[model samples]
Target: MPWLISCSAGYQKATNTSLATTFSNAVERFQRSYAFPGITASYVLPDGTSHSAAAGWADVENGQPMTSESRMLAASIGKTFVAATMVSLAQERAIDLDAPLSTWLGQNNWFQRLPNHRSLTIRQLLSHTSGLPNHVYLPAFVETVSERWPEPGNPFTPETLVRFVLDAEALFPPGEQWAYTDTGYILIGLVIEAITGRTYYEEVNDRFLEPLGLNATSASNKRRLSGLAAGYAAADNPFDFPVKTTDENGVMFWNPALEWTGGGLISTSRDLAKWGAAIFGGQGVSEEILNTMLQSVPIGDDMPGTYYGLGISIFRSGPLSPVFGHGGWIPGYSSSLRHYAESGITIAFQVNSDRISHQSLSEIELCLARVVISSGEKTDCVP
Candidate 1:
């Protein structure tokens, strides 16, 4: 496995001049508009350059200010990393994109136990058309597991998480209707582990993170990371439910095992934008892999132009702008990454509160798009 080496501390220091003005403006607006405790916004322009800003607090209890360096959970944004890993491996011929998963993961009795298990393919898993039930909705699993391990001391092994979903039945035939399911990504993560003979963390670290020089970000197993933001029900002060080390913090449970490839990684806005620049700038993966990752597959009619490609979502309304990337909500954290290929603009925002709506993310995106389109410049992504 080719691992990406973390950047040296000196190299990790980013020059602030390029993005200082736009980032500062975004932060000021975000602070005024929302009561979020902490928020981070980052932008990557077409030239593969990035700028970022951090506002509010990472830990309101300690009065700690949010820094551009503070790492927060990427939530479902980790899906892009998982998709990249799979595509890279597929390109290497280690995993087949079209072959049945059984070719890689032998037909365990568990497959015989589930309906239409043999029909599952690698593409279906990546695009989320595998018809697998959403594992995150399994009330018993989280409650049962938390009761056993209340504190954030433990992590879920890939095998353990797969076993938990073995009993889950498919929602439809493979490549049929679209359904959002964490179970699909969980299986993908397991496949990565089995094929590489390395843990998901190790594979991602080696294959993705290191190459991008995302030294400060990582796929964390621990509940709270150093220089990391703690999730809260409210993004700002007076957090109705703050995550305590002792118990499951209402909706803010920190389960790296549960998120896995679906939503586990920890990163800062700055590193996240760097990741966009790395992948889109054709650094590690081939052009074919990048194209494959961007091709959007129809989900269902209910959501117009809403397609799942590799790890991200594609939302297209008109020729003016077609956005690519995913939006994530894990308890107190809500994040969205929108990349406009035609404009060569990427906007990434992270909020440290749970109640922040997807509509808010969409609005933020619209605001940024207007600024970019009006200025008609490849210079800055103002949000």
Candidate 2:
């Protein structure tokens, strides 16, 4: 149950990017202000120029300094991979985004039992308008994971995870209301497997990871990962996890692959920043499919001006120009990826702990962005 304290590490990026020092100072400042154990950040400018940095301890207890190469679960930020893949598949005519579940899984005996299964469409699932309950929040499911964590093997496959929502009442009739649900993505994983006759992870690797040369990214199947930093969480968190999710050796107690299609990639900030640049730059998927994914739907009042488009989020909230991206979270880890529309810059930020607030993270992010904006001003332009 004791974590293995990792060795110290530091940011390693090409010296060409002039903002390296500024980015490093900004990360260290916010990480200290917020008292985060560790934080890593990376950005891709409109021209595809990129830089990265890290601060604090990746393993706080043993003092392993965070590094640019440190890996962490991307949580929902990973959903973008699945969403882009699903959209690409749609573009290939392998599946229809508007098709109902009855098209692919209608013959399965359990399909009819899923709430809204008869009316659910691929678009609805990606847009989170399926009204299906989130399996991760189900009491029984959370209890099982918390109690049996550290046990070998991932017991929850897409098939097994679906059972949590079986026969559960729909939050609302399909497409009538919008609610976020991981189960929808879990089901999407199953459909991808069904349609392509391959594991969801394999398909993603073929489409994104390998081609993009994202050497630091992978399907987060096992508990332990090299370069993965220890993640700190609340002891009383809903997942019933200990304060640190990984040991000093960077091994987690249980397989996070259970996240599967719901959100499964483990990667460094560099890879995430590169992936974000590709996505928003019209290189992640076919232009036609990417256009389809941009048709967003409102998430109702609480999030005003924010909308969901496929697996990505479109934010019109503040004064920082239009933003398109997604955030990710699981116990002990949190991440964010955003593309600044007007500036054409993409930035990815991650932390070893989930204890920090979104506002604080955003403060750190906008601060770093200001550096880039100011640098552009010297040239008489704003990036």
Candidate 3:
């Protein structure tokens, strides 16, 4: 859901320092300038320095402060977790990356009903070249989510989401074009369950989360989460959420399960940075496979200066250029995680409100970069 994002590069063990002070100041400055309720940021510089900062209220009504540890829905970034697992499996020859959808999903009678389902392959889905239309944006799906308000108890199964796009016309032939779609990742999650004989969350949990000690990361399947920040949305947004997304007691109104494998994890800025550092820093997967992941194709102006390779996003233009990572967005949260390739720095930022414009998001991303990579020079995140 993020309109912008930032991770990739060589390894570095960053420690705490002035990047912390500047990052904290810049986060506070942007949080105020944009009148956002709350925002958090974390970074790992090449100098063995890593830091996290936050400003404003996590829950304005309850008067809870948004801390560096506050958790928010990570949105599409969750796709990276799924992609990493699938890629690792591919690397080990446990899963064939080039296989067709029919390899695992063909058993379903409705498999051919999905756009390009006849010829879609695992790699195309991973790189978002599946040409499959996103089910989330379907008018029927949106109306259904709104009609089924109070998303808890009334969950949208991953298969049901794909069904919405059934019989839908193809956006283009498989592997012929690119379009970002949660439906593709949801399919990946389903394939994971089929191939591993287990849930996708369990696979990711056992493979990455537990061993890496990413305790702050958890699947966004519950209505109530510990230390979760209140998210803000527009009064008349398409998703039909309230202006304030959480209750007075910090419980969410919607069923987080609706996001599923598409982008269903909740995490903090600190955990986000660590995950980026570990994964993109050449520790998550072998460099040879990582190079294949970095084989990016242009993603067009929707993400200007960005390219897609496997599940990772590479922003190759502007001040944040030549960095590898991904962006995430849900109804009420926006997130960016990036590893600066040129300087070996990893930074992550999360906002509780989704009302900010893409331009503002870009400015905030640039300011954060300027603060950390400028060698303690005076800088502002605002354009």
Candidate 4:
């Protein structure tokens, strides 16, 4: 309650309005516009005050009302955790970021078969400069998943997922061009596992979740933690074909193992906001490593002023100042985690509908940013 009160006070002092009231109104507007089953958002202001808001039903069929604490799949936001863990390991000399991944995971048959696999480095994989094909986007992989989806208990291993892109041509020579590929992260996970001789889940749990006390976050697909929000997709969209119902029960349609390191973690908005504050605020890792993670690669004109960093996206061209974070989509969930460096604010939100597009998500972020900027001290809003 104090947190909420502080947020309201902060907003009133800056904008002469109540933050909770305006935030709740914004959530309602987004819910009505997107028709999402639920939407949850949390934030940490420049002054370290925390606030959260939720709207709609976490489980539409069950009529469970959504709360700000609802846990949901965070998709590629999990990649930030992976990047942090790897960077920490690099600091420990457990692995080298620029070392060829083949040094660690070369024994695997899949690695031996992929072109330039021996030359791909950890840095390249993290930044999506490895020219690896994104298995989830490949037509054959899509067809296969479409045919086999919603099958209960059907899971895929990292090796199995990597095989989907094994024979496909590279996007470009390694480090010569930038592309986004989940397969690269899959390899990164394997390398992490190989170096530590422990499952990637274990490393992340110890390196991040435990130290940060992020009890609600999990890296595995097998743990059936309670209170997880139901996932939903568009029933009317052809792209969401063969998924007859919006229901996205894990046993029915999702195999968290398939997403693995690329897009497979579950967390609440509160936990994600905490993570954004810690990781981007330099509490989660060394300042040097955080800087490395923030370093950007030119993504070209298709995405002007946008760049992809270690595990997050950077945007510097908008009306707002430079902001960095990642967005993610699984079948029934979409999530975003962002940090406004100039304002020292972090916003983490998730909707239970993958039907929402990136552009829509950006609009939502912009809306929230405007409120935060308006609600903060004038100096905090200065670019």
Candidate 5:
């Protein structure tokens, strides 16, 4: 229902490189353009050389400085985490990407109203092509049930999220159209629970977070993370309230049930980058499963530059370089984790304020890309 915001620092050196000036200039420009409360950036090159930097505040109200260890709401960027979990399951033979979900949920009668609902596979869910509408769109349900929910100190269970999706109508037949449905990922958490008999949070922690040593990150049920910045929204009534607590806005509430697999995990830039490297480097899953997770699936012509692949979006560069990874946003956060597979380099950006639009972020990202491309060691240049 809400996007997760996060950023990763860059630290990598090309075989024969010189991009320090370009990288510095790009970060300077991004800081100026957004006036972001804080930023943490890291990049790792193919050759094992890297660089990382931090700028801005981790907590604006308290004037806390942003750090590599400062945790932030990852927003929807958590989808990749969901994706990674499923990928691990696939490797372990607990789930099959091509198998229908009805195998796990049971009974075609429940979803029989929707054509091909039973035929929908876990893979489709991962790629957001199952054609399910966002369950959070039901205003009545969000107002009543969500209002009764707790605050950041408490997180909703994924089962609640699954119930919401099961009650909603499918957007289209499985694999028929593309809509970035939080329902798909919510279902993913369900599948994990159904098999493991553990909470989605625990599964993620035991399987991915703990092994990776991501001590400062979690689904963040509030409780003032050690160095987390408070997220800010553009305010429903700007004159009356320039920025509001995410809790005031039901959609902005940090209910794990609201986002589930789609958006919910909180993470720091350092941990986010570590997770990124783990995914790209094939640390946890088999090569084949990772390939499926990264392969692009068609989203039809309506959604430009939006292609679903496993748990991430394969954003084709309109005029810039091709990038892979998902973007997430919640009430007070906007974030993205992208990497160039060919170059073995990654870029993560997270902001505490959602007032900055995606278009603006894209422009800023393009400028950053230009810096990375132009300043890296050129193959054409003779050594």
Candidate 6:
């Protein structure tokens, strides 16, 4: 799969007409190529100009069109929200990042069951260095969930998820080698609940959504908000496969209680663009704390120029500029949120299909970057 390469040169502001046309065409190509049920994308320039484009069907069965306001599950992009919230909590002295998980969560049955429970720090959990076994990767866990799908009382609690991985061995010693684990963020959510005496969702709402006024973003499994785009999956696999509307496998069937802080966010590209500007542009955390959160560790040779920070991934590979954001994958949705620091531009896109490969998503982002760059000379666009 060849990716559309991006030029490293500085970007100039292009007319909204031209940018929107380019973006819309690119999105149409992406949709047709991957047979995505629908795709919604929005970009915010530093000067506050916003451009949005949507292609395909939000509800294929009903012939609904994808719109800028259509919401899609934001998968792991929720981790970036978790990371920002943690930074805010640390600043308020509500929780210490370096503190061991045992300090706040307490030594319950789950803690006692897992060795080295006391050695894992909040920082490690945020950075995926806690060596915790990812519950999603466990075959038994996946099978159990699949067996219970769409059934009453099938949702797994955060504690239950921790218990499922308690017997599994650690991937590495805490704070040693970097490894991405949804279990780490699950623990982080639990820690937040412990320290604040409120559910993780509540804290996120108060700290992030409320302050930023991002009304479109919320936990997927929680309340049913309006304008949510229906989710779908490819008929076969996502790679080099065709998508079918009847092949729908929406996240509505998944247990929201299980995904929690790991990847349960549902949001629109417009709201996510606002979130990217607020969180990455230093609206929530102080400069020092934000810098700390952005500091990343390499994940080894498999992913060159790719590093994992607290709840975020930093990509510096190829001629494309470095971006600070995260991608998300749930049952019936895929999302990508990116902030190009040099251009002061933030782009976010969400599709109803989860079958799209990460590489394909990256290319979508690259296409957006290419459009922004090819527009003309530099402007005062700073987010």
State which candidate has the highest TM-score. 3
Predicted candidate 6 versus true structure: per-residue lDDT over 189-293, tens digit per residue: 887777788988899998889888889888766434356777776555322123432224433444455688897687899888888877777775678877988
- Model 1 gets an lDDT of 0.69
Greater lDDT among 1 and 2 belongs to 2
C-alpha lDDT score of every prediction, in listed order: 0.69, 0.82, 0.82, 0.78, 0.64, 0.76
Cα lDDT tens digits for candidate 1, 281-360? 67757899999888768878887867789997887774345778787777667777777777766777787767666656
Which candidate, 1 or 6, would have the higher lDDT against the true structure? 6
Which residue pairs in candidate 6 have backbone atoms (N, alpha carbon, C) closer than 3 angstroms, thus clashing? 46-382
Clash count, one per candidate: 9, 6, 16, 0, 27, 1
Against the true structure, what is each candidate's TM-score?
A: 0.85, 0.92, 0.93, 0.89, 0.81, 0.89
Give the Å error, residue 337, model 3: 0.8
Instruction: State the weakest 10-residue window (summed lDDT) of model 1.
Output: 1-10
Pairs clashing within candidate 1: 3-206, 4-206, 4-210, 36-235, 36-236, 37-235, 37-236, 332-353, 332-354
Per-residue lDDT of model 2, residues 1-383, tens digit only? 01111111222333445566666666776677678889999988877778898998889888788999889999998899999888888888666788788888788888888998888999999999999999999999999888877678988878889989999999999988789999999988887888899998899999999998888999888897778889988778987788888765668977888898889989998999999899789877767877888889999988898999999899888746578888999888999888888878788989989987777666555656665545422211111
Q: Candidate 1: lDDT of 326?
A: 81
Model 5 Cα lDDT, one tens digit per residue, 60-171: 7666676666566787888888888877877787567888787776653444443356688888888878887766565654664545544443434545545555656667
Error of 3 at 293 (Å): 2.1
For candidate 6, give the lDDT. 0.76
Alpha carbon lDDT at 228, candidate 1 = 63
lDDT of 5: 0.64
